[model samples]
Target: MRCVVLPGVYPPQEDTLLLAAALRRERLPPAARVLDVGTGSGALAVAAARHGAAEVTAVDVCGRAVLTARLNGLLAGCRIRTVRGDLLCPVAGERFDLVVANPPYVPTPPAPRPSRGIARTSDGGEDGRTVLDRLCAEVPAALRPSGVLLLVHSALCGVRPTLALLAAAGLRAEVADRALVPLGPETRSRAGWLLRRGLLAPGQEKEELVVIRAERV
Candidate 1:
């Protein structure tokens, strides 16, 4: 699908593609309600809409991302509701048949989150679970009975913790797909820090990105 990604907005990458593939495997009824949290460029939202989802709501905290997503949706010929808010805030009190997210999961040094620039798109705090943890914790509240969430993050963030968190949140969660890709520039620059944090082994250059499927049971 064609998408217009502004400079500050994250462009679709491998993780996005993986999530889209996983989304295709799900059975989205024609009237299914879908939500794409952190919908960078609205790729997943449009994909969900194209896959027969009747309604798609996309949320992002970045103003540029919100506009970019809206434009991308128009370009893709899908009607997507784009909202600007952190994580699930914009969709409060709403339940969705399907939820998708590709939140920041990179293990970065402890520091105040940047107000503008690429850090906001990739930094996920020390353990790389800052954003992911919140997503796992709050998703249960937004998911209808039997609704599914498709989330993607790197294994460096600890996949088991994510699973345990979702399980504790009353959702049945498991890794549905995985891809071993070379570390990107950001990760490569933090190689030493990741090594010190025991997240990356010595000489380890590849990271496994996992697509997790969690269902409200």
Candidate 2:
């Protein structure tokens, strides 16, 4: 797909493609509403639109990301409503048939998350569930009954907890997909901290990526 990714906006990566593939497997109604949270370049939004979602909305906190997603949607010839705000904040009181997210799941040290810059795209709190947890908690409210949520994150962040949270939110959740990928730049930079925290073993260079599928039943 042709996409315009500006500086500081995240480019499509493994997790993005994984979530997109999982998205295609979903059975979307003809006029289904789709929400792509933390949509970096609108790749998943475009995919959802292409797969028959009548209304697709992409949300991001970064200005560059918002522009990039809008541009990519235009370039892809898909109609995507792009909004700039924190995850799910812009779409209050709205509901969707499908919600997709590939949020920041990298385990960084506990500290105030960056308010701007590229770091904001990948910095998750200490255990790496900062954004993931919030998404799991808030997304259920945005999902219509029988709606589905597809989220991608690293196994290092703990898949079971995510499942538990989603289940606690009344969604029937399960691991839909998994893949082992080599650590990227951000993960490599935090290798020492991760090792010290016992989140990673010495010489470990790969992490498992997991896609959690939850349905509001």
TM-scores for all candidates: the values are 0.97, 0.98
**Which one wins on lDDT?**
2
Which candidate tops TM-score? Answer: 2
lDDT of each: 0.92, 0.94
Alpha carbon deviation, residue 13, candidate 2 (Å):
0.3
Poorest 10 consecutive residues by lDDT, candidate 1: 111-120
Candidate 1 lDDT, 1-217, residue by residue in tens: 7678899888999999999999999997658999999998899999999899999999999999999999989998889999999999888999999999999999999888888767789999888999999998899999988999999999998999999999999999999999999898789988998899888999997999999999999
Candidate 2 lDDT tens digits, 25-144: 999976899999999989999999999999999999998899999999999899999999999999999999999999999999877878887787889889999899999999999999
| Candidate 1 stretches greater than 4 Å from native | none
Candidate 2 Cα outliers beyond 4 Å, as residue runs: none
